[model samples]
Target chain A: MSATLDDLDRRLLWALQDDLPLRERPFAVLAARLGVNEDEVLQRLRRYLAEGIVTRFGPFFQVERMGGAFCLAAMAVPEERFEEVAATVGAFPQVAHNYRREHALNMWFVLAATRPEGIAEVAWAIEDAVSLRVWLFPKEREYFVRLRLRP
Target chain B: MNGEALFVPDERDRALMLATQAGLPLEARPYHALAERLGWAPEEVFARLARLRAAGVIRRIAAAPNHYALGYVANGMSVWDVEDERVDEIGRWLAEQGEVSHCYRRPRALPLWRYNLFAMFHARERSEVERAVAAAAVRLAARFPGAVRAHEVLFSSRILKKTGVRLDF
Candidate 1:
């Protein structure tokens, strides 16, 4: 679906990237800042979400801060079995983000688990189910970079 | 940093997390709405959220726009096989670039994968992303000659699944 954003929508999208206030009427604060009413802000956000312009709207939790683990993994699935392997791999709840990349290691995914050990367990189970070796590339160090898309 | 010692959410906090995992209610008083849902006072809910934020458990309460819908269709994972001694410095430098969204140093699986540094770049056009990657490589080469052995930009063809880290309650 084509997203034709208006001026207000564009401003709202950009504004929403930052942290919303922790107040009783956070949206009201945002609306006042944007020179719009709270009802308009709510309506626009609802429409954006319904139209899939905004994938999610809420608090972003840091799993690592909560003692969780996240690991990046890759596997090379045969061209013929790519779809099947993807289905099997994506079936796991721990597989947070899976993508088909152009490389020998075609299937790349991220596994997130509550505990550090759960990461390996999920990888092993996925390997057993798909009958393919899963290469785990856990981050040794992370360089900070905030993601902010211009609306 | 020990996350458990930093902030271990008790049963109530877990309930709060479960309630807002999908998202906060789109209301004038979202915290109050959450308070009503969990049968807790608004003040207590706000206090817990503030504590979580302070503890770094919650990064931010914000909106995640759909990149594709926003015209950021080209997503490139730029991997560089840099010298071990300079990877961290180079990774930090790459992280500073505006084009880079995420940068990390990961273990290299020899004989198969040689790249240890990964940086993600997204743009509206594939050529734009490629240009940025090329520019970055040129800058890296100029700054640190012979530090990078090889590099490749792996563009994602499709998103098979994308549910951001849904932890079971």
Candidate 2:
């Protein structure tokens, strides 16, 4: 997958992770820093977004800061019933990211809602839909860490 | 963090969020494009965005690359059962490690689940992730000894869904 990316593309990917300049021509500023033309930068970014190389490309909002809540929930489903449960859980708009992990508690997902109470409400609704106990693990404290993946 | 009042997005803010949640327009003047779409002045759009950022509602205007597409195929959620008293200290320590992307102190479900400290590790290969976690475990044991108990790494087998936070206004 990475073989399709060139040196410029890799650098652009790394650079895009940082905050973009809030100027009239943000792409121009980025292009300058990357030693590329504005058109080239925009073209590559469009391609990246279209190709699924970049999942999202805009403001990263912290729901907590906005008085929203995010909770990590998990459930252990029978192997035969895993797909059904996953589909049911994934149907909820509050489910931001759901993953099938290798553990007794296999179905893990992150729930986000506008209000703190809303998280539990969604979890309960999912529980009702799936007939499985949803264990919510709200973070008591978050340790800060910056992640930058080198391409 | 919960003590602070929530920053409720007004109608305009909600409209702006809905418009830009997918992404900023790839144009010479993205904000202007947004303003035109929302039928607001460009300056108003800029001011609102700046205010939202200052209020911490918007973490940053950035790009989130797909880790798997970037060749980071191995992603592991490392959970540990550390002493309650030292969990914070250990979590802070783990957060400083390059391999640890996110570290948090969460409640442990007794009996079945005993992990309170969670840290995510990502690498190009599963073996590399395992080795990194092993090295971190050894170091953690050396530093905290008895405080560190059982640990497990749950590798993600599949992404059932991954649409980041979509709030219906």
Candidate 3:
């Protein structure tokens, strides 16, 4: 869906995405910088959330730094077993996000654990429980990309 | 899903989520630092994060230090065409690996874009990604003989923008 962004709204978004400043009264600081009131800052934020401009507005952890292992996985699921397999996969604590794709390998999701070895364990668990062949596609390197929305 | 309902974040939880998404202080006491800045109690800050976690809004609050700067330079998006009967299990298994961080199953394109399962892999060098892909291919071929009809790998050239979270206030 298209996002309707005004000057003020864009300002707020730009500031927040860059990283809130470190200081007492950050809202006030932001407001002053944007030439608006703290309440206005809060109100606009509320509107933004209500408008669904943001899918998630919370802290995201660095799995590796946090002593955890995370990876993205996909499987080709039969039509009849879609829901059952999705539920099973989602039940795992490591499975963070699950999606239904239109392909032979329709099921996809993420998995994370405290240890690197846990990767294989979780994968095996799902394979055994689901009774399907599983593939382990791990990241060999890292590339950080921050997607920004233009105002 | 309706676009309106899909993007809306609850008002009560906006402040905390916004703070984290915007970015957190790289300090010993990050939570405390945020509390001091927001003029709220440290416990309050932690409490909000906990609530967000429980609510499935904030999945995890942590850092994604500069990957490229740190030397993990190789990365690629791999797509596979696995049999529908085994894709679900295979996807879950793949996600359980540490190397694959981003996984998705998009609607398959016709003859040209037959690979439906997409997974992101990061390595210190392009060779690492190739090795991983080859290994994964071998595993798949052994596990599901004659199952995967095709596969493709696309490396990321230049990262444009990747942050998706938006906090309006």
Most accurate candidate by TM-score: 2
TM-score of each: 0.96, 0.97, 0.49
Give the distance in Å from residue B106's predicted Cα in candidate 1 to where it truly belongs. 0.5
Q: A1-151, model 3: which lDDT tens digit per residue?
A: 3465677876777675554443445567768988998878766665555555543343664445423466656677787987788778776766765655444556656667656787788899999989986665565333323433334
Candidate 2 error regions (>4 Å): A1-3, B2-5
Expressed as tens digits, the lDDT of each residue in B1-169 for candidate 2 is 6576778788898888889887888898999999999999999899999988887889899988888889888999999999999998999999998988889999999988999999999999889899999999999999998998899999998889887778875
Cα lDDT for residue B55, candidate 1: 85
Q: Candidate 2 falls in which docking quality class? A: medium
Q: Weakest 10 consecutive residues, lDDT, candidate 3 chain A?
A: A141-150
DockQ of each: 0.77, 0.80, 0.06
For every candidate in turn, the CA RMSD to the true structure comes to 1.6, 1.3, 14.5
lDDT digits (tens) for residues B89-169 of candidate 1: 999999999989999999999999999999999998889999999999999999999999999999998889876667775
lDDT of 1 at A99: 94
Query: Weakest 10 consecutive residues, lDDT, candidate 2 chain B?
Result: B1-10
Scored against the true structure, residue B109 in model 3 reaches a CA lDDT of: 45
- Deviation (Å) of A67 in candidate 1: 1.6
lDDT ranking of the models? 1, 2, 3
